[model samples]
Target: MEEQLRELGLEFTKEVREDFVNFRADPLAVVYPRSEEDVIKLVNFAREKKIPIVPWGAGTSLTGAVACKGCILVDMRYMSSILEINEVDWYARVQPGVNLGKLNEELSKRGFFFPPDPASFFLCTVGGAVANSSGGMRGVRYGTFREWVLALRVVLSSGEVIRVGEPLRKNRAGYDLVHLFVGSEGTLGIITEVWLRIIPTPRQRLVALVGYVSSLDSVAGIIIDMRRSGILPEIAEYVDDEVIRALNEHLNAGLRKSGGGILLLRVDEPDSERMREILRRWGVEAEVLNDEEWERMYSLRSQSALALKASAESMYVEDIVVPVSRLVEAVRRLRDLERKYNVRMPVIAHIGDGNLHPNILLERSEDADKIFDEVARLAVELGGSVSGEHGIGIQKAKVMGEQITSHSGKRVLEIMNGIKRLIDPESIMNPGKYVELAYEINRSEERRSSS
Candidate 1:
């Protein structure tokens, strides 16, 4: 196998290892391919050898999608390039390896910007974001990478390269196959190039309203009131006093501790008076900040995950979504877990959209699963998904199995498994994770019941 791979003339490193969460990619050979043709060649080799192939980006995957024991890990770093940015067409076509922040910076220079800005934007790759279908602070107005991706050029499991969709805004030429690859998590195929939809920079001078609420209940109340009034924010985020304390201690971010919680908001349209009225009714202290203060607040919000991680070596980052109506209930459930477990679960949320990340700080690594399950179960019971942005790798596969089976039919999982079979017939494309793993869990349950 080494002899054959070495003969391909692509840059190869033996026994390359990459780690994240619980998944480790200790590949037999890590190959760096500089272009689509090179990726095709490697893919062909993997197929012929019946070896698994995992495409890697910046390795920012919170899930275990990138975990490979002996698969051929294809690192796309060498292929990073911004091929074109057409302002008129409103699309930026680039190689999958381009850093997301770099791509946005280039777009911004041309008076346009890509909307999906993940917290890992500084470190993550456009390809990784696309595969995860990642959402961010701007997600309330802009949505995730799934919505921004106009088209993709992918190398199929069979080593066949095909381009799906177009750079144009309106094209109904075929089935929506573009979306199928958006969040496939490198399972379907290796994404070679990406055509992302772009938008002109907003002309409006947006200001932020930082609400220091008396409690999380009040925070939830403000969000519900804002929604009820038909006011849409560019971003609506909430972080409890615990996360604020973490930021101050670890990041040296001098932020006021909102005794109950802090609600950070930005508006495309100015309506601070109305927002103040809502906050005033809840007896919350508020301030509409200048750009400098707002920028600091925004940066603090983005660094929240890192701040909380300083407490313990590890944490179970919960990415659960509840209905907007059930936001208060979700917050209350988190409070109950803290009291029940006698531990702090610092919450950081994209509150406008109901996606909450309640970091379960672990004293011991083994202790988080039980709490994790309860949180996921809470989302499911409340008619919400187990995950909103963070994709299911190995960590959430069991819950995904239960969620899908209970909400959608068991047949839905079968259809998903069927799609995986259809695309990567050999099951050698990032195998043993994501949807495949979820289905396997259900099948295992069935067998246990029958036995």
Candidate 2:
């Protein structure tokens, strides 16, 4: 296989490595594709040999989506390029390997910016973000990569190139296939280029409000109240006391250890006062941050996961979301689960939108999988999703199967599986992950129950 790859004049590596989430990948070879032609060639070769192919973009995935054994890792690093930034069209088209932070910097020069600022935006790729439909702090206001992506140029499993969507706002197309591939996690195809919607920079300055709550109970109540008051913040993030401690110990964040937790809210200049009023009404000691202080605070929250990872031997970051109305009850149940499991599940949330990431600290990974499933199940039971932004890779596949069956019905899963088959009939593109894994688990359970 290495010789065959080299014959095609592609840069190839025989080594495999683990992703950020600690999932190991043992690829037959890692091939770097500098162009769409290279990707097509690699795909054709892999298809001919019946070899699995997984796309790699910065390896910032929290799930095991990129992990493959004896497969081909199509490293898109060399394809990094900002192809076009249409100022008039309000879109930026770029290669899969373009760094997200760099893209934002370019957009900023034009008085525009991409809104989906994932925590790893500085290090992750635009392609990776689009693939995972990853969300971040601004997600509370701007939504996820799923919403920002206007179109994508993807190479299917059969080595055929296709563009999913137009770069325009209003397009009554055949179907919303753009969304189907947005969060597909590379299971369906390889994203070669992306066209993401951009917006002119907001003229109104946003004010940051830090509310020190006494407990998760207080934080939950505040979120519920904020929604009731109709005070939508640009960014409503939460970092628990334990997470604060981790940040301070690891990154010297020096954040105050509040009794409840810290609610970092950023709203437009006009709504700042109302946000403060809501904080005080919820018994939270609120203080507005200066411009400089706000930047540091946002950076600290963004680094919370890294801090937690450093503090623990192993970490399973849980991404679950309940309805806004069920936020309080969800928090209470999460607290109960923490006590029941006897683990330090330090939470960080996009609270305004009900997305919670409780970093579960463990000495060993033996229990991580079990706990991951448990938390995901709780989200489903609470009338929420098992995954809000992070796609369901191997780690959360069984729970995803359960969620789909219980909520969207078994037929929905079948339909999703059918789409996967429709796109990648050979099943060589990131096989045994995402929807495919969940469907596999469901089918196995069906077989067992029928027996």
Candidate 3:
């Protein structure tokens, strides 16, 4: 396999060592592919040998999605390339490994920008974003990764070059295959290239932070009211006191200590005067923030993840999304959960979309593990999922059965397994990460016997 991969211009080194996970000596070999052809050959070889081929990005994934049990890890960074830019259609065709920050920097010069800005935008690859269907703080208005991705050049498990979807706005074809591959999590195929939809940059913008003394429920209610009043900010985010404290301590920002929570919002328009008036109407007490200050605020959101990781010996990040109407109840419940679990829970969320990231900080103590388990269980009972942006990966695989209650869950698994079988019958591509080979085979057998 190594020789075949190398023959196709790929580079790899085999080492019996622990990758990413230092606590547990996880076994895996990391391989970097140089080109699309190299990825194709590697996939084919993995399929032939039934060896798992896990697609690796920036290793920013908190979930065990990229973690493998002695499988071949294919890193796509080396294949980073922006293949084409279609000015006529306003689309850019790029390799899956393209750095999102770099791509956006280039796009900004062209008077366009990609909207799906993940927290790890600087390091995460487009392939990683597409694979996980990632969304950022701006997702409240911009939507998720699935929204921007128009077309994909993916290599199936069987080493076939198949193009799915088109750059056009509408497509009512037989099936929407492109979306199916969006959040597949490397369980279906390897994405080599993507044709993303870009939009013209906004002329001017205003960002402000609001410190609310009332409960999150009150804030959520106010947000709904504002929305109903036709005040649509480009971004509306919420941060809990713990996260605010961390930011203040981490960055030494002399932020107010009185506010129980913080709401960061941004408005972008051609006329900054109108935007400022709109904000003032919302009682923001608007203070115009400079670019550095705005970035400091945004970085505080991104840095919260790193802070959580650093503060604790071990931690669990929860991506729980609920109905917009239930936003207050959701936030209130999280605070209660923190008290009940006796853990420090820092939250940063896209409140407009009702997506809250309630991160539980835990030390590497035996007592911490028990608390972590209980909190994980409580997260689902509160009408929220275990994961929102960070994928199930291996960390939350056990919790999969909890999310999909009815045949809907079983049906989803079946479909995923069917796609896997159709693409790679030998069960090689990222084996054990998603649906198992037996699961699909059993379903097929049941259908055959029934027929």
Better of 2 and 3 by TM-score: 2
Best by TM-score: 2
Task: Please tell me which model should have the higher TM-score, number 1 or number 2.
Answer: 2
Model 1 accuracy (lDDT, Cα): 0.87
lDDT: worst 10-residue window of model 3: 17-26
| lDDT agreement of model 2 with the native | 0.89
Say what the RMSD of model 1 is: 1.5
Descending-lDDT candidate ranking: 2, 1, 3
Each model's C-alpha lDDT?
0.87, 0.89, 0.71
Which pairs clash (backbone N, Cα, C closer than 3 Å) in model 1?
A: none
Which whole-number lDDT from 0 to 100 does residue 341 have in model 3?
A: 65
TM-score of candidate 1 relative to the true fold = 0.97
Poorly placed runs, candidate 3 (over 4 Å):
1-9, 15-28, 204-209, 212-214, 268-286, 364-386, 407-409, 435-451
Among the numbered candidates, top lDDT falls to 2
lDDT for predicted candidate 3 compared with the true structure: 0.71
TM-score of 2: 0.98
Per-residue lDDT of model 1, residues 212-317, tens digit only: 8778888888889988988788899999998889899999988787688789998754676677777788997678889999888888888888788776667778
lDDT at residue 291 of model 2 (Cα atoms): 88
